[model samples]
Target: MNELIRLVYASKAAFRAVPVTQGVEPSVARILMQSRRNNSQVNIGGVLYFGDGYFFQALEGDRKVVNQAYQRIAADPRHREVTILSLKTVPDRLFADWSMKYVPVEQAVRAFVRDRGYLRFEPLQFQEEEAEALIKLFHQQRSGEAPDIEKKSGWFGLRALLPRKFGGSAGR
Candidate 1:
């Protein structure tokens, strides 16, 4: 059987706000478009959540390919303080159908944060488990699955902005 791996990570946006681009499209939108194409070519799949100057991404694919892709992400100037939250070999991908799913900062997520006493979705303030939970929550919401936000066990703490994980080093 082919080996599959899941890599989860987060990072802070280098810019304080989404920067305007030369074209009609916003920079973030261009990034999403480019990423979707690139990820598809490499057979990578994942979900990306951007909010409050932060990013939480989960990449799943062949171990080596995922690692290579992550290297490029870490080196990208748009991302700062990239940190890995989890790197595990899962039986299957949680986001296999998506090349790069971008989760918008919608009302449901805002409500979830406010109800939890968080002023915003500042991932840097979240602990490892909380980061993972947030990623799962967004993924569920994007996939039209009902997330059990009432499960209090999964949310807590904030440390750094970006969470990233892969089998190899960033420079590789």
Candidate 2:
């Protein structure tokens, strides 16, 4: 069976990373390698940003596999206060090639703006359809259920933001 295409986004945890048996950076790298080597993922892809003692990352792949990856990731002594950013269906796989890859924000921001246009990238907000998908993703994340991402809902979701609790006041 062909794996379903999906995307999972998370804005670094608030508190602190989970208990890392290893040190810090080395332990993180080790966990990433382990995940790539022995993970049940279809095509995990995303970025990890380090700022304000928080780590924001997005992982995309098969719904089941991706969800499992999140749980495992949380267990790591490298992240905490996990607040999922978004997880929705995309006609295309964001990163179908790599099992796991780093997203250089400086480079990715430029690319995202270029591909999505200045307005699309700005506070421009999601289109009616995208809003619904994002909302569904948020709900799924909170309830710990598979995203109803593919379905279309209403528009109020555009204002439905993830609680500030997920993001602690740290970064500038």
Candidate 3:
């Protein structure tokens, strides 16, 4: 088996930001749903943060699997200027329970950005220390089950907004 590894990357959104409803943008929701499905199948776990037209994601899993996944992400049309921030072997997964945990850019992160002299969330400008701090914050967050779209009737509304290629269903 390949050694467990963690890979962090940042990317700028290629698509326009959709209005956020139910605390997440439509495009992001689609991405999160797909991630949950794909990662779970490959025994990968990760945390994703989306804000201010940028994405900072940390994926942990077998080294080969994680690298394959990163290659797919780098070629995704929805992302531009994708750049790896960190990649290294690790003893274990930090987000073991989450196939793909979505971490909203909450207050603590906002303060962290301001403290670093950034007016908005911009992971591309982050140095190694800032990136590591963000990962630490991700570790501190409690892991929750990925939202059950079928059970949460409220999410059904989001299905309509998804592209037809994705089957317009959460995690389909």
lDDT of each: 0.71, 0.45, 0.83
Number of backbone clashes in candidate 1: 14
lDDT of 3 by residue, 10-108 (tens): 999999998674577889989998998898789897899988889999999999999999999899999999988888788988877678888775687
Candidate 1 on 85-155: residue-level lDDT in tens?
Answer: 88888788777667877766457678877876888776656666666677678667654321223112232
TM-score of candidate 3 to 2 decimals:
0.80
Write the candidate numbers in order of decreasing TM-score. Answer: 3, 1, 2
| Model 2 C-alpha lDDT per residue in residues 1-172, reported as the tens digit of each score | 5454354433333344445443345544565567556532444654333333444455656677777778777676555555554556666554343344443233444444456555323312334344334323322232211112311232223224434454422232
Q: State candidate 1's TM-score.
A: 0.70
Point out the higher-scoring one by lDDT: 1 or 2: 1
* Residue runs of model 1 more than 4 Å from their true location after superposition: 18-25, 114-117, 143-172
- Alpha-carbon runs more than 4 Å astray in model 2: 1-7, 11-24, 39-43, 106-172
Query: What is the TM-score of each predicted model, taking all chains together?
Result: 0.70, 0.46, 0.80
Candidate 1 lDDT score relative to the true structure: 0.71
What number of clashing residue pairs does each candidate have, in the order they appear?
A: 14, 8, 0
lDDT score, candidate 1, position 95: 75
Q: Regarding TM-score, does 1 or 3 come out ahead?
A: 3
Which ten contiguous residues of candidate 2 have the minimum total lDDT?
A: 143-152
After superposition, the stretches of candidate 3 with alpha carbons farther than 4 Å from their true spots are 143-172
